[model samples]
Target: MSESEQLMVVDSTGQPLYPATRKKIHQEGLWHETFHCFVINHEEGHVILQQRAKQKKDFPGLIDITAAGHLLAGETPRDGIRELEEEIGLVRQFEQLFPLGVFLEELILGDLKDRERVHLFLTDESMPLERYVLQTEEVSRLIALPFSEFARLTDETAETFQTADQEIIHRDQFVPHPSAYFRRVNEGIQAYRVQQT
Candidate 1:
């Protein structure tokens, strides 16, 4: 995302305040809106994860949600669907996304203070890992892990994941979200899966 891009700032109640540049929002600790999309392969019972590009401004080189990006000023949560294609080359229609829920996340990392209203979405879409045209500047690669294994790791009940090409250590390899956040996400995925059956 461009540093100069305008974003909507909101009060504690999520009411719009005023527009500010992306940089200003972070520097001022202003609450802003972002979107997170998680893609699940229901048939395979796995969730897709993306490795953020090392050059990213925040959380560089971390394993993150399937696709995520800031919602530009005046853009609705549904407008965020473009991020799937822009970040990972997955073209999805707004109607195809199942709304999971919105979450508020506040973090203070060094000089960056982030307060984000995250609009989460879930989708059961399967595609070959090799077929993903990753935006090299935003994402490095993609991986799929069994949802059960992912939940176990998040719950500290598992240690490592061994894939054909590499082994992933859970600790610093993934984003440092609160445990409850991961649990909620897992619950949402499971609920969607049950509804499908």
Candidate 2:
């Protein structure tokens, strides 16, 4: 394969298995490290979601985590954090965000096979949404769903929502289902709101 062609491997469970180098794994499928940041703007009662660029190899134009990236070879999880800042312009240290553990999974994105050891994080960060200097090739748009409305959307009969902006593109990406995580996160947000009330 050419340098541009990345090889992927999958474990028995179809999880991505990362190696100590950039080469393909001996086993079937591919291995990649991914970073996911669930950013909550507590004051605004909204969670930031990004619409991945259409040019992405997979899941393009779908609603995704606040930020994410693949871990380069010989790089630690910390390197993934740096990618978040580079990709989304959020400046923060790993210690500041709460690590939500890893989501080991495999997914087929288009013709490309993607198996990822996804590290998750949550942070309460304050910033002007407009100030986000988006990496155009990586992110197309950003949207903030009201905490209540987001939870409500999951409960409704509808299973998906049209992504914000242009208002016609519906999102269908579903590796780590948004509703699955949204439901869990909503509980925490709701409890916090109740306490304040």
Candidate 3:
């Protein structure tokens, strides 16, 4: 995680532009690709979330996607499977994942302008929480929250998120992706559930 990432930069329309360092991409607001995977257990009504390590530069100590990483310069969305094992010690095959389509998000954190085409996927995991190994440099811990509750995460009236450990959190405790990002992910999860039944 200490090494600089070489990212494949692209235009807003997804046309290849050039390769650049992760720092350059953020500093210049250049569009880049990222891989996002959400692990869910539909029968148990839960989805896994990762708590970021306190030492992270961006969004430290926040709850975020179960497994995610920026795609390297020559990596495909399929290559993102490595993040599952790297971050959470869960090995997966590309064929075992569900496609959730690419999503676009633009954000500015102080002088950092982040633009990304997020390639999303979903995988089902129903294992006991303690069985998973976490890479402490990137993740603090993992939690499974009811999918029904997660759907209401961005609601104005939903003022708090109570974790499995009984720790209470506010909307700000989540990695600050736009509300649209959460909304679309919620819709995608719902649609996926419908297809399974």
Candidate 2 has its poorest 10 consecutive residues by lDDT at 1-10
Pick by lDDT: which candidate is best? 3
Query: Tens-digit lDDT track for model 2 on 22-42?
Result: 234312346666677777777
All models: lDDT? 0.84, 0.63, 0.87
Which candidate gets the maximum TM-score versus the true structure?
Answer: 3
User: What's the distance in Å from true for residue 172, model 3?
Assistant: 1.4
Could you tell me the lDDT of residue 191 within candidate 2? 60
TM-score list, all predictions: 0.93, 0.71, 0.94
The order of the candidates by lDDT, greatest first, is 3, 1, 2
Give lDDT: candidate 1, residue 135. 96
- Those runs of model 2 whose alpha carbons end farther than 4 Å from true positions after fitting are 1-28, 152-157, 160-197
lDDT of 1 by residue, 2-46 (tens): 889999999766789899999999998999999999988888778
Using TM-score as the yardstick, the better of models 1 and 3 is 3
Q: Report how far off residue 117 is in candidate 2 (Å).
A: 1.6
